[model samples]
Target: MKENANSALKIVASFVFVFAIVGVLYVVYFNSNGQPSTDVPVGVKTFGSCSAMSSFIKTNAQKSYPSYWGSGVVRAFTGVTGAISASPSMAEGGKATDYSTTNIQVAGVDEADITKNDGKYIYTLSGDKVVIIDAYPAESAAVLSEIAFNSSTERVTEMFVNGDKLVLFGDKTDYNGPIMGAEISYRPYYYRTSSFVKIYDIVDRSNPILTRDVAIDGNYYSSRMIGDYVYVVLNSYVYEDIVMPNITAGGVETPVAGCADVQYFEDVVDSSYSLTTIMSINVNTEEMSEKVFLTGNTQTMYVSTDNIYLTSTQYYYEPMPLVGDFFPRSEEKTLIKRVGINGNTVEFKAEGSVPGWILNQFSMDEYNGNFRIATTSGHVSRSGGGSSNNVYVLNGSLDTIGTLEDLAPGEQIYSARFLGDRAYLVTFKKIDPLFAIDLSDPTNPNVLGKLKIPGYSSYLHPYDETHLIGIGKNAIEAEEGDFAWYQGVKLSLFDVSDVANPKEMSMVSIGERGTDSYALNDHKAFLFDKEKGLLVVPILLAEFDAEPQSDWDYGEYTFQGAYVYSVDLTSGFTYKGRITHVTDDSLLKSGYYYESPYSVKRSLYMDNTLYTISEKTVKANSLIDLSELANVSLPYEGSDYYYGYYGV
Candidate 1:
């Protein structure tokens, strides 16, 4: 009887122990929120080397929980291997090849002039290399011919076709010897430079000739042609000097400033220059002139029939000023100045100011008799971070028209466009959404509707008044150490005929997926062809599988390319075809051999050709004939450059 009783007691104790263990397991699993379970061994250090802990768990633990058993085993093995191969393998260079048999003609030009002329024209700065390609119905278009420029390395900064004259501006700067002696190379100095503006007579496209070149002290940033006068914005440098002195203590010497009676000194001045001028050139006589339009720090300018609008932002610098030292001052204000063009005098009568941040993004459109300015405050948050979507509207006189109500909490606007009686705003969050507002009444705007999507829509293009096109996607990172490139390019079409209820019609994914920066139509399509539509879009592709660096965080990663797509708004806004990267073998080889670190700069569809600018090359511009690639298929092979610097 005693032996049987002892055995029963032992069995009850075993049951109790098993029940306690089960309860503990249940609690842990419940706390994990349905995630796979992990072992927490007693007396074992959780924060120790992952590989060591993994090995311990594998050896000591009788069995892993069924839920996390696979992941736990894989992690343990991976940790050991990762520790052994802690150092990554060296990356290799990448090469891209043409997989298609189609031939795309290269116009042999780097950098074409982009102007919203009748259509767009690709003018090679090197020579009279002009290729007029059609942008309408992007497919089935051909290049007109190769037109040559008058000079080599003329470097056209701004060009506009005004009736019979092609008004152009060129900048050439040469640095004199060091402002200070080379022996005192650490010191800074300021030097003067010169630039010029030229006008060309292109009345006859076949026999275009340079009319005149006017010398100026500053480089021209932009220009506009009105009547016989060509208005130009010139940028010049303004220099200032700074000094610093060294102090010593005993004759043997202490280099402290407060220690010495007789001090040895060194003067260090920042000899940098700032932009400061606006000039006008008479197209008829080619004479250069100036106006008294004083600006603080201008970034952009726009001119209409009645007034000229100038956007300026205040620059901030560190190091507060001492009593007698020349320290930088903070101008806690942003200025939007409007000047009236009375005769030749630009009367700056109206101005407006905003607090804390400067103007970083803006869009201007004229409605009725009033000009509407949609401006966004710089990404300056109270927490000292960047946000892109705070939007404000201004009137023609630079007055605060109104501010758009913030659509989503913590969401900021990326872009705003005016279409007929309404305005479309693009905002960025986890995904992008289109907010439609009725602007028939400029003062009291109404949020008529909204549309949201999975990716980012950076730019919006409207076809007629009923249809809209959006270009957007999340950027992809290049490699382990490099930045994130663009990824998942999607083109979405929307029907906005009903302002209150906008609907998405269709979407198409092109290339490997990328981003679109700009798109336009040729003059023939813009003016005459209503039945057939032509649209040109510039697309920049992100490197495959590119991701952000582990340490740095500045969400900018993109690869450059130009894509021209044709849209038919009448038929569910269908995309016809695309013409991209149609160039000579030599040019393609050069582009492949020389990779640019910066994004693709600009693309313009003018006359009948497509012009593209490569930011990677010093003077990278290419002109391509659209007709050659109408039937060509783009190759989708992988890149050869493995970005990893593993072995080296």
Candidate 2:
């Protein structure tokens, strides 16, 4: 994975000003009953009325976060579709019983992805529509049906297919009028953003029935599906007027949260406030439930089978008023709120504060009724700030029972994964240090061993109980600096059977600098079947005809497709074959490197057939030798193109 170098620069830039960028942006509201007369949960406070909620917003916006403003929005596409090639008669008669599922963190909990399969059929997004393809047997695959979305302002990010039901998660932005009473000469339009969930009955493959359409106020954060329930999280921006978000089901619209339904922690003093809303939907029955909380800013969220952990970054600024100028120093902390999950009943359980910021969802884990989190502290905004990493083990009540602090000074965490009784962490500055931490003792977590290597792994996956797979970038240390210049995508197999000594068993590098892969960032893009010794990664390969003159030199884009490898503990990664959706004519017309509409983004296997999917095509190949078997082209090819790392 590519390192984010701009973070250090942003911290340096913040020192020139007294008031830094406001972390909190919006308020999230959910439709619920009036506040209960009973006592609120511990560490939770409620407004209890509309007037009280409005008063809190006014006081915080004016006195505490006077410079708070809305943050920027991000927009991206998933996949599109084209047409099918082979006939239905060419397919084998029966459905495949052996198939692979999405790569998820926990066993029972499922994460939404762009592509999913049910052995016999494939479900994926194509432009603004959902395309269902009859994919099986490798010989014949055809487009079964396409469901086009009518809304232009909405984009479905991902979906989940359970049994005969298809649940789609989307984001919609509507022009909610203009901002009033602004100091500017012109009026700025305000767009109300919300997340929507649409559940469809796919009992009949050619035509899907829409059973539920739910629109919740706020921007979509992330979602998880477990068993019959789908949990969606959203973050809403709060305005001074205290415009509340509405929960619209079918057609009836209700205010998502009144003052009484809103809950907050009195201990967390954030510069601004955000209304974080979490909703649970029963996909089978179309029944929904929601809970809203006032948090610092919803950052990294980790959900297990029993609970959801939401984390937000909190900043403490110290003002230094000089005779003529002012400067402010700041420190960073993470506020974590744990919410219990039981069917549709979502309630706050505990709250904890840690000394740093988390990397992502993988930075935290839950096991044996305890929560473990890894974070990086120092060097956020302070001058001469040296970086350090730490891990905290919290019990059910969110109390820190064990801590291992200041493990790798001047280095930050690149990736982390928690297995059954051990935790693996990778930190990198000039070299990647893979640390094995013992977590069997919840009250005394400590590091057992460390392995220093030349590159870093941005993502880690447990191959089994004793082995692991790492996907990241290969780098070489710069001659004059305390850092390394990343070269290419690196895949490694690590043997961790020896809890006290971890070693890189085998490794391979692809392309050179400027090469990229979707699997490096999104774990869903990675396809691994340990039983079959198969691993597939969607990569955009870059290379050079001659040796580079400097360490900063990058390679040119040469190939774009999926790299198939047979990986194991003994032999490591062995190249099997490569699959590409780009045609030879298209590559030549665009100087040998064009972001083809058919750039493969994901891969899956059903029995012996491997399916490589992209925006415009889905091709099936033989799992043994990767020989082309069938080509299924989707109908709609929209104007938007995935430019890959080489942007448009």
Which candidate number has the best lDDT?
A: 2
Model 1 RMSD in Å is 25.6
- For TM-score, the strongest prediction is 2
Total backbone clashes of candidate 1, pairs 3 or more residues apart or in separate chains: 45
- Candidate 2 matches the true fold with a TM-score of 0.88
Instruction: Please provide, for model 1 over 436-526, each residue's C-alpha lDDT reduced to its tens digit, 9 standing for 90 to 100.
Output: 8887777777788888765555556565678776665554433453223444556677888887788778776544432334322111111
Each candidate: what lDDT?
0.40, 0.75
Per-residue lDDT tens digits for candidate 2, residues 1-648, read 112225432343344233221233222233335233243675556666767766665455434334333221110111110000111222334788678888888877888988988789999977777899999776778999988876678899899999899999999888867666652222235678888999999999889999888898898889998899888888776654566778888698988666556655544444555667888888888788777766544777899999999887665655544434323455667777788887776777777777777788889999999999998885522232367999999999989999999978888888999997899999988788999999999999999998999999999998888998999999998887577899999999999989788999999999899888888878888888888898999888878889999878988777888999999887999999898877653452232322455678889888889999886789999998888999998865566333333222
User: Cα deviation of 286 in candidate 1 (Å)?
Assistant: 3.7
Q: Where's the lowest-lDDT run of ten residues in candidate 2?
A: 75-84
